[model samples]
Target: MTVKEGMGEEPERYRVEFASGTAASVAKRRSFRDLERNDIERDLPGWPAQPPFKVRGFFGKLGVHVLSATTGLLMLPLYILAEALGSPASPEKRGELEERENEIDDFPVMWAGEGETARTLPWQLDPSRRSWRTVTEIELAEQDGLVRIWSYEDTGRGSRHLSWGGGEKVPGSEAVLWSMPRSEITSAEIKRFSMAESDFTVSFRDGSWARLTSSPHGARRIVALLGQGVPEGCHPA
Candidate 1:
C-alpha cells in the first residue's frame, strides 16, 4: 500500500505484520513484557496505551557496554557525555509527546520498515537537540499520514546524565517523544563509520534534525528503509 499524507485510513490503519510476542530480540520481549506490566510504562509519559517493540533490558544493556568497551573503542568517548545535561523532556514537553500517542493504539515494531524511531542515537552520535538527546531509545508508528516517534530510557540506568543507577525501575521508559506529519520529514539516511558503527539521520521541515542508532542489525534495516541521502552535514560518528 502507498503511504500518503493526511489520509487517516482508520484506527488500526497501521498494520502489524507480526503480533506483540513476535519480537526480533529476546531482550525486547522481556523489556516489552515489563512495559506491559506497568513498570516501564509509568516512566514514559508520552507513549501509546500499548507498548511498541520488544527491546533489550538489563542483560542486553550490559552486553552492549562490555562489547563497546572493546570494539566501540576509540569511539568510547561517544558513549560518555553524549547525552547533554538537562536533556530529558520537560513536563509540558512530555505531555506534548503523549498528545499524539494517545490517538493511536499500536506502534510500529522495532525492526519494521521505516521504523527508524525504534532506535536511538548512540551517545557519541547524539544531536545537539535536547529533545532527541534525552530519548535514548525510541520507535516509530505511522498512520493517518503522520508518523509518531516514541522514546524510551532505561529508568533502570537512572537519569539521562548518569548511566549508573537512579531509578528502581527494572526496564525502560515510554513516550512518543513527539511526531510529525510525513510531509514534514525532508529525508532519512544511514551514516556508516565502521562495520560496527552506523547512525540514522532524519531531517524535519523546521530545519531541525534527529540522529538515531541501534544494534548493527537494526542500523542496516534503518538504512534500507530510510534510503541514501546526503551525509556531509550529518553528526560526526
Candidate 2:
C-alpha cells in the first residue's frame, strides 16, 4: 500500500553513525543573534539624569578653589630646595667661587670643593684693618726631580696664594704642588713625569682649560686656568 498523490515526499529520515559505538542524537539548533541585538532596547529601562555638579552652596566652590591654590603655592619652596640640592654645580656658582680664590707665584694652594664652591682654610683677613704690616712667602723645592714640600704659614693677610720656583728655603713658608680644584679636576693619573705629560689638563668653570705637564709647568698651567687675578675668568665650566 503506497500512497504518493497529496504528499510531496516522505519527511527525510537520519541515522546516527559512531566510530566507537558511542550513542549520538540530533542536537537542538539555537541562535541568539536577533535577541542579543534587541535585548538592551527591549528589556532594560532608561536611567534618569544625574546632577550636573556637586550639590553645594556658592561658598563651597570658592573654598575649594582657594584651597587648591594655597596648596600649590606651599609646595614651590620645597621643590626649589630639592632641585638645588640634587643638582651638582652650575657655571654661575662655580664662577663665583673661583673669583673668590686667589693664586700666587710662590706657594701651593689647597682647596676643598663644596657643591660648585671651593673652601679654603685660615680665611683671609682685611689688610687695611691690620695695624702691623706682614708679608707672606711660599717656597717649593726639587726633590728627586719631583716637586714636594711641607705647608707652612707666614705673617701676612689671610690671603691665599699659589707658589712654585724660589731660590732659598724660607722658615715661615712651605713647598706645595699646585693642584686643580677637586670639583673641576676630572681625573688624576700617575704617569711618567716626561712621557705622558700632555695627559694632564686643568679645567675652569667658564668652559676654559689649560694643558698641563707633570713638571712644574703643570702647576703653573693650573694656576692660570683658575684665573687667580682675573675677576671675570673665574666662571665654572
Candidate 3:
C-alpha cells in the first residue's frame, strides 16, 4: 500500500506482540494526516481484548476500606444528636410533670351541666354562656338536727365551697360501692344522713345532688369538669 504524509509519500510499518509471544508486522503506505485523523490503535470488533484496569495494592486497598468505615461511624453520632435534639420530651421530663401534678393539693372543682337532668341541677350555672356571672353563696346551718344546704361560688382559691341539705332524712342503706384515695375527691359536698346505726356522711355532686357511689361516676364528673373548654370531650352523650 502507498501512504502520504504532509504532501509526501511514506511507508508506515508497525509491530505488535501477543501474550503467547507471537508477533506480527503490518506494512502500508498511507498519508500521516489520515492516520492522525482516524483512530487506528483500537482493537477491531470480535477481538477478545478488554481495556486494562489499574489496581492499587495492599495499603491503598486498606486506606479505602478505613475511609468508608470512618465515614459511617462519624455519621452515626450526628444522627443520634439530631434525634435527641428533636425529641419533644424525654421520659424523665414526663415523669417529673406527673409528680408535680400529684403533689398539687389545690385543684379547682369545675363541672358542666349538659345532660338529661342538667336543667334540674343547682349549678346549671353556665359561667361561660352568661353575660354576667352570678355567684350564689349559701351557708348550711344545722340546728336541732335540722340540716340546711346552700350553694356558694366563693371561698377563695383552694377552699371548698360545698353544701347538701334536703331536710333531715333517714340515711339510705349503707352500700360501700367504691372507695378512692382522698386525693381523688376533687370537689366534695358532704351530707350527714341519719343512719339507723349512726350519722353517715355522703359525698355527691353539687349540681344534681346525686350521690356518687362509684369510681366511674367520679371519673365521669372529673371528665366533665376538665373537658369543658375542649369541644370534643365536653359534649354530653
Candidate 4:
C-alpha cells in the first residue's frame, strides 16, 4: 500500500493505492479528538469545559489520590498479563478475525474496490450540543448515472467508546441520506476555513442542497466524484 498527500489549492487530498490494483483518492479530515473537543466547547458557549478541580482540604485530596493509586495497583496484574500475551493484532487482522467469528465475508472494506467504494468522510451534524455524541459517516459512490450519498448514523451504543465513559449507544439503524444523478448536481463548492477546516456544498436541481463541514480531503473527494464521467453500475435513480 502507498499513501501520498497532495498540496497546492487543496492540501487535504490524498491518493492511496494497494497492491491489488485498487486505488482511491481520499481527503483527510480533522481528528476525532479535535472534533470532540470542538463539540464540547460549542455547547458551553463562552465557557470552556474543564476538568473538575480536585477536592479541597488535605484529607479529601489524599483520599482521591489513594483511590486512584489503589485502582492502578488493582489493574497492574491485568496489564502485565496483556503485555505477556503481546499486543492485539492490527486492525486488518482483527477485521479478519471478526469476519471469521461472524461467518461473514461480504462486508465492505474502505479504500478497497470491494463494492461501489469511493471516499468515506466524517461530519458532525450538530456540533454545538452534539459534541462527539453522534457521527455521520458519509460515503460518496457512483452507481448507474447517479451519485449515492450513503449516510450511516452512529449514535447511542454505536458511538465511539472512550476511557472517560462518555459515549452514546447505537440509536437504531442506518439510512440513505440522499441520492442524485450526476447531471442533477447543479453546482458544488468548497468553503475553506481556518485551522484546516472546510465545508462542501452540493446543490441539486430541485433547489435543495446538502452541506458537509469536513476536512479539505473530504471536500476534494466529493469534487473528484462529481468529476467522474463514467457510472460504475447500471441502475435507475
The lDDT values for all models are: 0.37, 0.26, 0.24, 0.34
lDDT rank order: 1, 4, 2, 3
Worst 10 residues of 3 by lDDT: 16-25
Candidate 2 differs from the real structure by a C-alpha RMSD in angstroms, to one decimal, of 44.4
The positional error of residue 93 in candidate 1, measured at the CA in angstroms, is 37
Candidate with top TM-score is 1
Clashes by residue pair, model 2: 95-235, 104-162, 106-163, 107-162, 107-163, 205-235, 205-236, 205-237, 206-235, 206-236
Task: Give the C-alpha miss distance for residue 136 in model 4, angstroms.
Answer: 1.8
Instruction: For residue 153, give model 4's deviation from the true position in Å.
Output: 4.6
Compose the digit string of candidate 4's lDDT tens values, residues 1-237.
012223322122222111110001111111111111111222222333444212135564466557656967887787777778895322111111222211121111112121121222222232322344444443443334555433333444433334344344455645544345567665655433212323444444443333344445665676565542323221111
Better of 2 and 3 by lDDT: 2
Q: Pairing residues by index, what is the TM-score of model 1?
A: 0.34
lDDT of 2 by residue, 17-86 (tens): 0001000110111000111111111111232222221222457546655765696678677767777899
Candidate 3 — which residues are off by over 4 angstroms? 1-120, 131-133, 144-202, 205-237
Note the clash tally of each candidate: 11, 10, 5, 9
**Residue 147 CA error for candidate 3 (Å)?**
6.4
Error of 3 at 10 (Å): 99
**lDDT (tens digit, per residue) of candidate 3 on 1-237:** 113223443322111001010001110001000111221112222222333222335675566667656866876777677678995421111012111111121111122233312122232122222112123211111122211222223223331222332322124421221122322223332111111111111222322112211122332332233222222222112
Model 1: residues >4 Å from true position, as ranges?
A: 1-135, 153-173, 205-208, 231-237
- CA deviation > 4 Å runs, candidate 4: 1-124, 127-132, 153-172, 206-210, 227-237
- Model 4 is weakest, by summed lDDT over 10 consecutive residues, at 18-27
Instruction: Determine which window of 10 residues in candidate 2 has minimal summed lDDT.
Output: 15-24
Off by over 4 Å in 2: 1-117, 120-150, 153-167, 170-184, 187-237
